[model samples]
Target: MSTDVAIIGLGIHPFGRTPDRTGLQQCAIAVSDALKEANVAWNAVDFAFGGSTDAGNADTLVSELGLTGIPFMNVANGCATGGSALAAACNTIRSGAGKLGLVCGFDKHARGAFKVNPKEWGLGNWYGEEGFALTTQFFAMKIQRYMHDYGITEVALARVAEKAFRNGALNPNAWRKTPISIDEILTSQMVNDPLRKYMFCSPSEGAVALLVCPASDAEKYTKTPIFVASCLMRTRRFGTLEVFSPSKAIEDQKTVTQDASKVAYEEAGIGPGDIDVAQIQDTESGAEIMHMAENGLCEDGEQEHMLARGETDLNGRLPINTDGGCIANGEPIGASGLRQVHELCLQLRGTAGNRQVKASPKTGYAQVYGAPGVSGVTILNS
Candidate 1:
């Protein structure tokens, strides 16, 4: 028998700009919503895992939810944090170590951008400052190099933003619902060179929770439970500094997204052509296009052409970021990965409402990647 795990229930706090709640409070609300959706009592859960970065204490978030006597752990992997937590929960269920596990991810950007602790290197001018500086500057460098090497135009980036905003208009939970034109994105203020203010993700507060269980218990809860076909996680073994080197060889090897997708496709017994729907980490518009090519959805450098031809729209061959992705939905740090999963779950269950794709989505993939080259890919099947 296959030791497959299934998602019994899933819940998501509205993805928008909300300042009233802290990250912990957002997590508690999501957890309660998921339990109610799953028809499972909070006390009956066997384990709980919280994913976050700057959300105060991880354990405190669970405690605030009135959770006790369950093995609780925290997960932090930059943007891939929530995906990592969900993967761990699936592993536990597959191992028969737990009957029901709750994976919760939340983030409140009201506290401001999460900065890296400079004290970790112990003073006196390290090679680089940690935290938000590295994240913003590192991706900035990559974007510059990509534009230079590929001869990509500014119009390409604008098209990416336009596509995401168009999709976001249909997502009631998205932060930016108004559709933007290519001209508007091009004229937007530049945050990092070549990356405009409209290109980067907006910070917001939100939470997402999932109830995972063994395949045996799926029917007890949900009529439309989605199976966890595969879960894959990878880290940059050579470190981010290598990519910054002035060597052609090193630059060619800086394809972590492609590598992770290869592993996930093998484990799931499928390929990119088999995927009916997908949610990719689009912290910036460039990332959305780059990931599509890197994940084999199209040939390398073909994403721009795909977008120009309207092949990635909601009614196109392969609908991407149907929930507006991190671009329109806002990146809530730890809650991002789970939000992607939640969107995929909704697609598979036919509950996506107005934002639903017309394709018969039998399988879907959700990928979350971070600045340090950490990535997680979860494949779900209906």
Candidate 2:
């Protein structure tokens, strides 16, 4: 017997700038909608897991949403929190510890400057620098390096931004739906060297929730259910330092992303060619290009070629980020991973509407990464 977990229902509370609702309120809205969509009551959830960062305590948020008397846990893996929560829920159900599980993710934009806990990095008040200082700057450096090494042009990056914005225009819930021209993208104020504002992900507030249950209970809830074929997550070992760093001489080293993708493909009994659709975490345009190569969608240094050929567009051979991705949809921090899964579920169910691909998508993949080198990949099949 195949021990496959099923997603009976999914809910997303938009993806954009919202100043009125708190993170807790967004969580409640998503969770309630998920339960109603699955035709299951709150008490039916055998386990609950909330994914967030510094938004608030998961336990308290669950309590505020009236999720009590249940085994609940909080997951904080930076940007990958939502995907981590789903993986945990899948493991619990696969272990037969729970028949039904609920995973909720939400976040509110930081009121002022975004800061990190000093203890996490073993730094004290000396690390009072603004949050974007390190994170965005680090990624900007990577983008510059990638461009130089691969000879990728700015036009290639503009293509990525344009594609995402076009997709976002079709998604009512997306944060920035207005389509931008390549000239506009190139002229946008540069956030970092070689990375314009259009390449950066916008901060937004939203929530997302998912209901996972045993395959047996799938029919009881929704007739058109998606199966969790596999969930894979891996962290970068000291070995990856060589693969990603130009100074290292380790020629055989593999990136943390490729390592995680290998495990996920093996567990799903499929290869990259079998993926019908994908929702990759592209906080920046460069990320999407690099991930395409790292995830085996194309050969190393060939991402720009693929993009120029229109292979990564909505009507392309293997459509990616059909729901606009973090680039165009806005990154709601905690809810991003689940939002990716939600888009995949919608596509697999053939309910994506105007943004749907031409081919019949039977399998979908979602990937998200966070700082501290955390990563998550989930495979869903219809």
Candidate 3:
């Protein structure tokens, strides 16, 4: 369903390593850009919410931000951090507790996949020792099973990566800007069985921020405001089957992405058919394929067909991951979701140069899912 909140400004720090700057520093840069775009001063913000993984607490930003004294919440919900923060910020406005709010995400991670501990995730320590906890391992197994069940090919995986990098080439801020041929991608070293090194996104660093205000007051901030149609976050419930998951859902059941996407669509009063563009989680090529179906953009096994038909191309009927997604942008966990939103806002504003969707997209969708079964979805309309 429609909401009164509209995003008045957007800003981002390029998604990649900046050894000279700390994660929080990057966040500060994004915040300044966003505030400047919205023409809103820091002290004028009624409230703020932000999140990060490796960065310092988001609330600690006040020391450098002039201590506006507004409530600045710190969120840590793994990769879904941005989604949660944005939802909270929207609710703050919808609840009449605040008229203007800011939400941001940023992080800096070491090379390679995250070192996740089962116990740290609330599971037994044995789950980690037995090798049932690594993100790459679980992703590989899940995708392998999905490929078999749906007749997806190894070529499809390479195509996904190829598309991601191709789009990244157009995105100046993307980390992997050079496009690679499918042959080169397919020949890349295999990281986990069918998942090639090129197919997976590295754990990297970046930051993103957005300014939101009541739709009635959007003109006071910016000339082009993307209305917040809906924003919701959900977590996997009982009987959800994620193979490596320590929970009892291994037998298989509804996923958090499915549930969240459905509710988000209902709230936004739109469906997949209305989305001119989309940006779903693509930690790897396989995740993109699975999320396409899980988010109801397509039916089971239809991603292969969708890709084959060029439906996801920049000039096609629906362009997805126009900013290159996680594969080309790298996953800075906290900032990834907001990065998707930022790209969508650009498209809706008709400012996505070089990589812009030729169709003049009016509506967009995004989904971000991560560890502990948390998932978040948002719909935007211009």
Candidate 4:
């Protein structure tokens, strides 16, 4: 069965370290704001889908809100947690299970790089024992290879980070509002080879929530409803290479973002050329450059020219991460993908205040990639 879902409401709390608040507390604020914006009541929500890495039992949120006895499932898909949960909620409505539902994600990360057990992703103990499990190392290695193969300069990487911080300065919800120049980024403390401290996104705290219903009923909630044209999620193919993998793919390799984007465009009946704005995985500056190609927004090696020509800026041909992506807002695990959804929704509705893209774009795309080679893509139209 096929049905259109409308995102009538979206809410995101300020993204940064919130030492005073609990994960549930942050979620409560986001959900409350979303319900108010959607003009929806807690009891009216049929179900909820969401999860958090550091925060426990997402379903326990019912205690903070009302115990309406709705089905709330906990979803854990690493960094793509929010996208996966939103997909489940959309599927629930499309399958005739319910009309109105909630999709929420929140996370409170500790200081330092995100550390995980190697056994979780089928890695051997040597990874955990020898300290080869850090995600930054993987990002560095992958981008280093990409730059070498594509002849991308170190300045190109710095350019992406500079743009991210510049955009972040305009977003009140962003964690790092102070803008930095390409020179600053290039000279920042080196975390991994070719990646500086400013280039990497920190594990921060944030929460985001969306209220969705069938498109037919969206008018009842909001005048400018953002329709979810397509939502697709995919895991790694056999030859795909990603963070946490020990070996690299030699041939016939396609990244999960590429395959999932193909499905998203097919389902939406649109191509990359149709997208006016986008938000992709930017775990670091290089990730954005690589994802631009992987998501089919541009061909390989085109990013060098795009960055130089200001083609990806707010007033350029296609604006990305207009509301300060992971690079500025910081990655909140479960909430990261939903944050992208919120930013795109604002753009499609022409409500992205200071960072609003020109030309009044009618379509927007969002993609999120996580560890162990998982990707989720969503297309939104006004």
Number of the top-ranking candidate, with lDDT as the measure: 4
| lDDT of candidate 2 over 196-249, digit per residue (tens) | 899888667888999999988899999889999888677776555321222334
Show model 1 residue runs off by greater than 4 Å: 1-3, 110-114, 118-132, 239-251
| TM-score attained by model 2 | 0.93
**lDDT by residue for model 4 (1-382), tens:** 1339999888888999888998879988999999999898999999899899997778999999999999999999999999899999999999989899889999998989997889998999998888889899988998999999998999999889999999999999999999998888989999999899999999999999999999999999999899998997999898877889888768858899999999999999989999999999999999999999999999999999999998999999989888878999999999999999999999988888999998999889999999988999999999
Q: What is the lDDT of residue 191 in candidate 3?
A: 90
Clashes of 3: 3
> lDDT per model, in order?
0.80, 0.81, 0.90, 0.92
Clashes of each: 1, 0, 3, 0
* Candidate 3 positional error at 215, Å: 0.7
What would the TM-score be for candidate 1 when compared with the true structure?
Answer: 0.92
The regions of model 4 sitting more than 4 angstroms off are 1-3
Pairs with steric clashes in candidate 4: none
lDDT of 3 by residue, 211-263 (tens): 99999999998889999999989988888755357656346777889999999
Task: Identify the superior model by lDDT, candidate 1 or candidate 2.
Answer: 2
Model 1 steric clash pairs: 116-131
Please give each candidate's TM-score.
Answer: 0.92, 0.93, 0.98, 0.98
What root-mean-square deviation over C-alphas does model 3 reach?
Answer: 1.2
Model 3: CA > 4 A from native: 247-251
Give the better candidate number (1 or 3) by lDDT: 3
